[model samples]
Target: MTLEADLRGASAATVRGAIERGDPLPGTAGFAGLVDGALVRDVLGRELVYVDREAAGEGASAGARAEANGSASVWSFDPGGLADPELLPAGSVRPLRGDPAGEDRGEPGGRQVWTLPDPAPETDEGAAVAAVRAAVRESVDEVGSTGLAVAFSGGVDSTAV
Candidate 1:
């Protein structure tokens, strides 16, 4: 079977099993399959990790690594009644929900905390297109380089952007 067919045939359970058994899958680029309308990967190639609904809260190791490296930051739109920002130290966990009224806001302590409005829905195709164009322009401006590199995965979202 083709790679796409193999990916389509693989289930989350099967991928998780492979991870547990420390077995390597053939594809270098990860696969994205729709699970309840959310694009999810059975394996994350760089980290060789598997994530699904059941494994959502399984980022403790990544979090720990970030903390160890002092590169941890939390980006959220709403502080969620967090009056004392000091309560959240660097590498602390924060939940994301709701929308911000206006521009993004940030607070820094042990970890960097950024609160920005939730992204507009994908239904707003024009807005999405404009945002991506603006981002590309800004990125190119900052880089001040002739060529632009896009870490593309031949996925719909990256391709569209």
Candidate 2:
């Protein structure tokens, strides 16, 4: 039995493209980030990501978001551990140079406004089920014997490792 990731499930390259495009939720789970760049959350906003408020500043430009060396000051998947972290918007490709609006959509000052993709069609029920299983197996294997917690909504793309 093999598990295929859901329609939204994406490989590393695919995820990178999606993040650049600001499409729908990434093919993987709920979150993805570029090292030393902007931190991106899933379109569905299923996952929670935090960034340090002080470091991010108010309306920091893309170059200002993270240091030149790509240091993410205080971003974390854990909500409680963040020190004065703010929740990034869902489907937002942030830290742009200035306002994403009223300018070219592509890297205006090193930032892009997130554009949501079309909704996925619900087909391939059998394939989706198989993929679900595969994702679970892979996730468990990656986690090894460590205790893991998964929150699934009976739909694909939610069981993020």
Candidate 3:
């Protein structure tokens, strides 16, 4: 079963279309800042669970394992709310592959190849600043809210916002 939760803005529309068409997971670029949370099952039952990187620890239990990818960790799903579940080693378990409904795409999880944006910046500070400014402007325009709030930590990134 496909499940999406608290999707907002452009993604809410685009993903809704994909879901309606029974399409595999759609491109996620449109969801950059608007996805409050989302969980969707690919045709093979591989669930893509989105959680805040900051409070991710709160979702873990003794039986859950955390797979580190770069600076982020993907926590395994706990079958029950019990304090202790069978914790597999990090990276030991892979997402289940294949579609039970007989729609196999010859790929793991029957997932679609979604295009992603190239987030790399050119080697120019001025260009980087301009790009950031334009992105911020676009976000503000999309928000269309009279009130604005920033999750500030008084860091350089926060100050830039």
Per-residue accuracy of model 1 over 35-123 as CA lDDT, tens digit each: 22122233332222121211223322211111233333222112231221122231121221121211122221111222223555778
lDDT of 1 at 37: 16
Q: How accurate is candidate 1 locally (lDDT)?
A: 0.32
**For model 2, what is the alpha-carbon lDDT of residue 119?**
64
Could you tell me which residue pairs clash in candidate 2? Answer: 3-134, 4-131, 8-27, 9-27, 10-27, 36-70, 96-111
Q: What does candidate 2 score in Cα RMSD to the true structure? A: 12.5
Tens-digit lDDT string for candidate 3 (1-161):
22232222234566546545655446443331111122233333333333323323343221122343323332234323222233322111122222233223233222332323456668998998998899988987798556766688988888666
Clashing pairs in 3: none
Candidate 3 steric clashes: 0
Question: TM-score for every candidate vs. truth?
Answer: 0.21, 0.42, 0.32
How well does candidate 1 match the true structure in TM-score terms? 0.21
Clashes per prediction? 2, 7, 0
Predicted structure with the largest TM-score when compared to the true one: 2
Error of 3 at 40 (Å): 6.6
State the local distance difference test value for candidate 2. Answer: 0.51
